[model samples]
Target chain A: SQLAEENSWALSVHEGESVTVNCSYKTSITALQWYRQKSGKGPAQLILIRSNEREKRNGRLRATLDTSSQSSSLSITATRCEDTAVYFCAGMGYKLTFGTGTSLLVDP
Target chain B: EAAVTQSPRNKVTVTGGNVTLSCRQTNSHNYMYWYRQDTGHGLRLIHYSYGAGNLQIGDVPDGYKATRTTQEDFFLLLELASPSQTSLYFCASSDPRWGGRAEQFFGPGTRLTVL
Candidate 1:
């Protein structure tokens, strides 16, 4: 069974706009990770938020974790065309269980 | 730089044929995983290994077998391939010591077609 699932299957926005992807999990997790996969490429880790940490930021990317709700959110500020990819949220426990993913398209 | 490489980037085989997918990681991580990605199911773990000579069944381990012969090498075997098995396969490695932040490094992925 999938432990984590993204709220949106697809999302579109202007290049300069900001976007947020929400994810919810069903079980307790040690941490939640956000990953991005470009066309024809493997997924790469974007941000990892621990259970104890409510939020984390890296450059224009911000990730928030709400353990009380078993939910997480990833926000990208000033999106770019290069940001077009599929984003996934993974719940970390004994292993990483990935969500279906959100396909984000940043139109120039 | 740590890296993972998979051989036979693309493959085609007939039903009941045997196939082996190879993965090698230079990261020397203790955990190696095999996952398959389909249209709507996203990525599902097929098998995993924590060390050489150790194998753990994943959520979807049926019709698949895996062996970790060495710290750097992990192989997934399909003895009787079927069309339903056709999908993109990925190999990943991670160090458990990183705690909750252990980031899995993935290979480019192998595209397999079972006709």
Candidate 2:
């Protein structure tokens, strides 16, 4: 079983729309990280929110961690075609467990 | 700039052939990891090492072997190549909490195809 799992497999939204991707984990984590993967590229870290922190923002991206619920969310504001990619949330401690990921397509 | 680089960015080999993928990290981090990515399964850890000459098993380590020869290099080996192993391979290096850093840097990745 996957330690972390994303809510949706794929999402499509027009440019300028807002999008959110959710993730749930089976075990407790020291921190949860959000990563973005473009086509033919490896995953890149977007945000890292610790267990104690509830929310974090990086430019157009916002991430919220709910340790009580064992879930997290990544929100992209004013989406652009350049923002299109697969987003993954990973739980980290001694080891990192990643979810299947949510593929976001921002159509122009 | 901290960078992780993988060699033989693309490869094609026949079954039963021996293959070796190389990774180098210039960041000199203490932790290095190997992962394979598939369409529906995302990225799964194969192996990791904390420092030179150290190895640790990950979630999916079956039929795979890893060696960390130096602080800057880690290698993944397939003694008998199988089609099931055909996938994109990524090498990452991270500074462990003990090293006082929380970020992992990823390489460009290697695309291997076993026929």
Candidate 3:
């Protein structure tokens, strides 16, 4: 069983469009991190939002964390084909617990 | 950036076979981890270590044993391989000083199959 899970299984959007992936966790966490995994590669961290912070941004990626609801969202703007990857939200508790991930395909 | 590498990017074995997955980290971080990824289960922790000769049981550690021989090397042993063990495995390293906030750096990954 997964302690954290993404709400969407898959999403599709055209290049230059915007997309959002949401996640929910079952336990308390110190921080939440967003990671992207491309085909045949390991995941790489994209953003980290702390429990005390509501939002954080890095380049074209923005992440919002709501402790009240134990949910988080990652939004990408002006998406590119390179952004076609599986997005995962990992909760930083005593140990890192990851979600199943949301597969996002950016079509040109 | 940190460097983590896993050997034998792909492996295949039979039931009850012996398999060992190797991982090495170049960056001198104090913590290392092993995780398995399946279609429905994204990434489940198998084992972790804070230092050499130290091992910690993770969320899903059944049928898996891990050893940290040195600061840079970590190994996962599957003495009796099973079909359910067929999945993509990853290795990661982080600094424990940061506790839960520590960002983990991952290796490329190893795909394993069991008959």
Candidate 4:
């Protein structure tokens, strides 16, 4: 069983468009993290929201955490081709559990 | 900028051969971790260490060995590699600052192919 799972398998958007990827988890967590992995690269930390915080933002990326629902979402605004990557939401309890990931493809 | 780097950006090995993946972090973080990424499974933790000379078992630690030699270096050892071990390996470091609210910084990743 997976501890964290994302909503969409793949998403495509044109430049200047906005896209949102949702995620859900099964157990309690201390923090939730959003990571971006480009092609042939390792995952890079985008945001880290604690259980006490509801929302966080970094540049054009926004992340929201809902502990009550055991879910999270990552939204990208003004999308560009460079923003195309696989996004994963991870739950950090004693250890880290990652979602399957949502692949975002941005067309220019 | 603070970063974590992994050696042997790409590696190809035969089955039953020995493999050693090295990682180093300049962020001076306390907690280090090793994970492997597959196509469908995303990332699964193989092992971790809090500091020098400490090893912690992760969810999937069956056929892997790890060593934390210093504050900056952590190594993953595969004594007898198998085809199943073919995947992208990542090393990360996390500073437990801000009441354990800090995020983990990952390395560039090592792509290993076992034949």
Candidate 5:
């Protein structure tokens, strides 16, 4: 749960700009997942990166995992206002633990 | 698409009151999980089940109990609700056979308020 923590509490960017949310975990993880939660909805998985791989991508979303540093990052390219949401990074091994989350506001 | 639904989208209960949140997933996934989300703390797992009649403890299980009656239905019970338990609850289901259960289908979520 608290083992994973996001670096920033919030960030703001304009439309068409790219933004990244970072996370660090206290323990080993087999995989790292980035999830996005919009207002009034549950969190949805965006991308999953394995420890063996350095990066993974889905559509406009990209995820990178650095097992050696116990860190991960999710980057969104050409963000839209609809992309505004709380982003969380989850560490998955025997159990799945989520980071606090970084709220990203994409301004028009 | 995988579908998961939760009942009583909003709930308000007083201290010492009892509350139960219902969830049903049409995904036919074998694993279901219950989690609570709050400011700063993010999502903390309360409980989970691999199948019917099987339950597993999660990160935060002190004030909650859960039961999986069938493959599709899982219920979370709060016998004595407290203000600290006031948070958004979400139900999710996934199949372990898929890339270590990375992708989970989640319900809309139940907003619980305890006074």
Candidate 6:
């Protein structure tokens, strides 16, 4: 079973535009990690925000965590065609449980 | 650089046939995990291990068995393969020493087809 709900299954954005992907989880977690998977490849970690931290940033990627609401969001600024992929949010416990995922397509 | 690899990259097997998926990590991480990915469902964990000879059942462990032969090697076994088990399998490794917030590194993934 998936522990989180991603806002969209597919999203399209023009290059250089900014886009945000929202995720909502059902249970408490020690941390929330975002991952990106390109076609024909496994997922790669984007960012990990601990429960104690409200936000984290890596390059153009920003992740925000709100424990009270059990939600997290990932924002990518200045999107590029290379940024097109399926993004997943995972809630960490003894093991990381992944959400359905948001497929983002950055078109030039 | 941290790296995890799995083999065979793709496989086709018949129902009731025996299948084994292998994973090896060069990162020397203490934690290794196996997961399967389907179209509608994201990724579901099948099993994990904290160290050599240790095994922990994951959320979706039915019809699957795993063994951690060494710190760097893990194998998933399907004694009787079924069509429903056809999916892309991924292998990941993480180190807990990183303040309990280590990020997982994943392999390219193995595509398995059970006919």
Candidate topping TM-score = 3
User: What is the C-alpha lDDT profile of model 4 across A1-108, one tens digit per residue?
Assistant: 588989899999999999999999999999998999999888888998899999999999899999999999999999999999999999888677889899999999
Candidate 4, CAPRI quality class derived from DockQ: medium
Interface quality of candidate 2 as DockQ: 0.57
Interface RMSD of 3: 1.3
* Candidate 4 wrongly placed segments (more than 4 Å): B98-101
Q: What digit string (tens of lDDT, one per residue) describes model 5 on residues A1-108?
A: 377889999999999999999999998888888889999998898887888999898999988888888888889999999999999988887777889999999999
In order, the interface RMSDs are 2.0, 2.5, 1.3, 2.0, 1.5, 1.9
**TM-score of every prediction relative to native:** 0.97, 0.96, 0.98, 0.95, 0.96, 0.96
Q: What shift in Å separates residue A57 of candidate 3 from its native position after superposition?
A: 0.5
Task: Enumerate the candidates' DockQ scores in order.
Answer: 0.61, 0.57, 0.73, 0.63, 0.71, 0.67
Select the stronger candidate by DockQ from 4 and 5. Answer: 5
Sorted by lDDT, highest first, which candidate order results?
Answer: 3, 1, 6, 2, 5, 4
Cα lDDT tens digits for candidate 5, B2-110: 8999998999999999999999999789899999998978988999999999999998999999999999999999999999999999999987686325677789999
What are the per-model numbers of colliding residue pairs?
0, 0, 0, 0, 0, 0
- DockQ winner, 1 or 5: 5
lDDT of 5 at B105: 79
lDDT at position A12, candidate 1: 100
RMSD, every candidate, angstroms: 1.2, 1.5, 0.9, 1.5, 1.3, 1.3
Q: Which is superior by DockQ, 5 or 6?
A: 5
Model 3, span B14-51: residue lDDT tens? 99999999999998988999999999889999999999
Clashing pairs in 5: none
Off by over 4 Å in 3: none
lDDT of 4 by residue, B74-94 (tens): 999999999999999999888
* Candidate 1 local lDDT, residue A3: 93
Model 6, TM vs. native:
0.96
The number of clashing residue pairs in model 3 is 0
Better of 4 and 6 by TM-score: 6
